[model samples]
Target: MSGRQGAAISRDGTFDAFDLCARRATLEGIVDATTLPRMADGVADEGGLARVAWRIEGTSDALGRPALEIGLDGIVPLECQRCLAPFEGPVAQRTLLLLARDERELARLDGEAEHEVVLASVPLDALELVEDELLLTLPFAPRCERPECVGAATAAGAAEERTSAFGALAGLKPAPKNE
Candidate 1:
């Protein structure tokens, strides 16, 4: 497996979770946004690359169970829900996940601790992890905060004011009142 400055830990995007944690390994790479299929639905356009950098360090929680500290950061292109414009959203996340040997252990760890717990499964897909973290960090309804977007919003409101809700009814008039 490679370190921070080298190639990805694995070409297939999978890695041994326990082994990485034990070795305190770091994997950093740049992946085109288009490569992440699931993430495509959330992005406005498939025209940018995301910088994925992560590291797994060994740790022990209060329960003395094996744990891994994952630190991830990246930037993803997203469409502003308000203006329908594309923008860049930054992702920065850190999580401590307890390694559970089996489903029973996973349930037990989850019930006992506030930290997240995952099965210590081998060959975990690193890209999927990165994608998940990035997705979580994204805003539920992203809106561009730039001055241009603000101006666009103002223009939209003005356009709305020029049109009336009753405009469609203006063409039709009430029939002559019954005498």
Candidate 2:
């Protein structure tokens, strides 16, 4: 699905406290080209849509700006790296966000390279963050348990060709030998 959108930020500059109780969040109107976080091992691929939910908690900083913590639980459909089959699984992660009131603070926090820093002048979309984190959590290389996972055997049934990309050139004729 394409054109999906994340949960909307509220006008109050804070997520509705009641939303945390709903137990579900629907992200809609997002575009297909959007990318998610991926596992460093190169096993996980976030090439498609994701559905998510989160439990949120928050408090105020010294200036009364909202600071939020989110615990995510969700599911995503992905293709197996080995079998090339599609499957669905759970995605879980934790994120903390800081809401900034002034443009200067937002710019300052956004410029920081620290991993934990997330700056927003208004209420941030927790669902988007959760989706992205799930992408990051994916395995670098997902594989199927079956011996046929790589399609080593029964090569004909495999979805992909077994030969190397250069195989075609190998068959080309060499110059003729002396008569």
Candidate 3:
């Protein structure tokens, strides 16, 4: 059966942390980027479909905390930062979020220089989880990957037209030496 054959799960229909971990639950779904309110703005107004896969399995991370691994595969249309033209970019994101039950543990993990952990309540919204991962996968300043792009207007010409703020300020005079 298709992973999404069942009725759509609501934000209130909760998943049991214990059952998920015990059964190693796996779920899949499709998200039309154009319809997701929180994420619609980030993608182009054109075609955008996301295939999502997620899993929650038993792990020693802790109890009362949901450790979810999310995988995202899709293509998002983005405007090139250099050329200001639109292009399709491939996205494949896989991440592990270590959730902490209390502030103490959250703080401890935050203080660590290596990994990140979130403080989330159990029975969290499943669709929200998928949306969060998708949002995180977008590029901050998307640029086309075409090799021809290197010396094209998107790259060289644009760089030549825009100067750093500091560079622009460097031309200032010293007020006639304050004489």
Candidate 4:
């Protein structure tokens, strides 16, 4: 694939994960979800910007595996399952990604790897990485965060109907000893 610029450095250029890890590079920038199709599809409004910050740790983990620390922050417009209304949900995540040369290496490190293992590819696609992280952080059940929302109240009480079947059956049994 053709190379891109910005956090996603051109592959022909100096964008290899190995080099980045060696140099301990840090990239801090704002990426547009509007630019990432997969991310854009899930957003209620594709106009929001994603703030991504990543640092390649020169040092390896206990397993001697290269790792990158990434953080993301953005407001994702999504439909609230609670209220069935559109709301801005805060998105944030920070995780360490362990970089491996190939699937074999990744598999070897699976048990000992303290962080998520990823295949280290050339011309690292920073934008794709950012989008993937953001997509994973998306709220599984988007809902209005407000405590007083009617939807929240209804959902809270919805479980009240759940009762122990044995308890209900006991109530139905007459108090025979009362006679």
Cα-based lDDT at residue 18, candidate 3: 41
Clashes of 2: 15
Residue 61 shift from truth in candidate 1, angstroms: 3.4
Decoy 3 TM-score against native: 0.67
lDDT of 2 at 151: 51
Using all chains and alpha carbons, the TM-scores for the candidates as numbered come to 0.69, 0.44, 0.67, 0.69
- Cα lDDT, model 3, residue 70: 63
C-alpha lDDT of residue 173 in model 2: 61
- The lDDT of each candidate is 0.71, 0.50, 0.61, 0.65
| Regions more than 4 Å wrong, model 4 | 1-8, 11-14, 46-59, 62-64, 150-179
Judge candidate 4 against the unseen true structure and give its global Cα lDDT, from 0 to 1: 0.65
Pairs that clash in candidate 4: none
List candidate 2 stretches off by more than 4 Å. Answer: 1-51, 59-66, 135-179
Of candidate 1, the 10-residue stretch with the lowest lDDT total is: 1-10
- What are the per-residue Cα lDDT tens digits for candidate 1 across 19-114? 666656566555665567787788767546655566555566676667777677667778898778788877678987788878888898889768
- Residue lDDT tens for model 2, 27-107: 322322124333322323554555556555554434444555566666556567656776565566665555555678767
Model 3: residues with Cα > 4 Å off, grouped in runs: 1-14, 48-66, 153-179
The true-versus-predicted C-alpha distance at residue 163 of model 4, in Å, is 13
Alpha carbon deviation, residue 179, candidate 1 (Å): 17
Once fitted onto the true fold, the runs of candidate 1 whose alpha carbons sit more than 4 angstroms away are 1-11, 62-64, 147-179
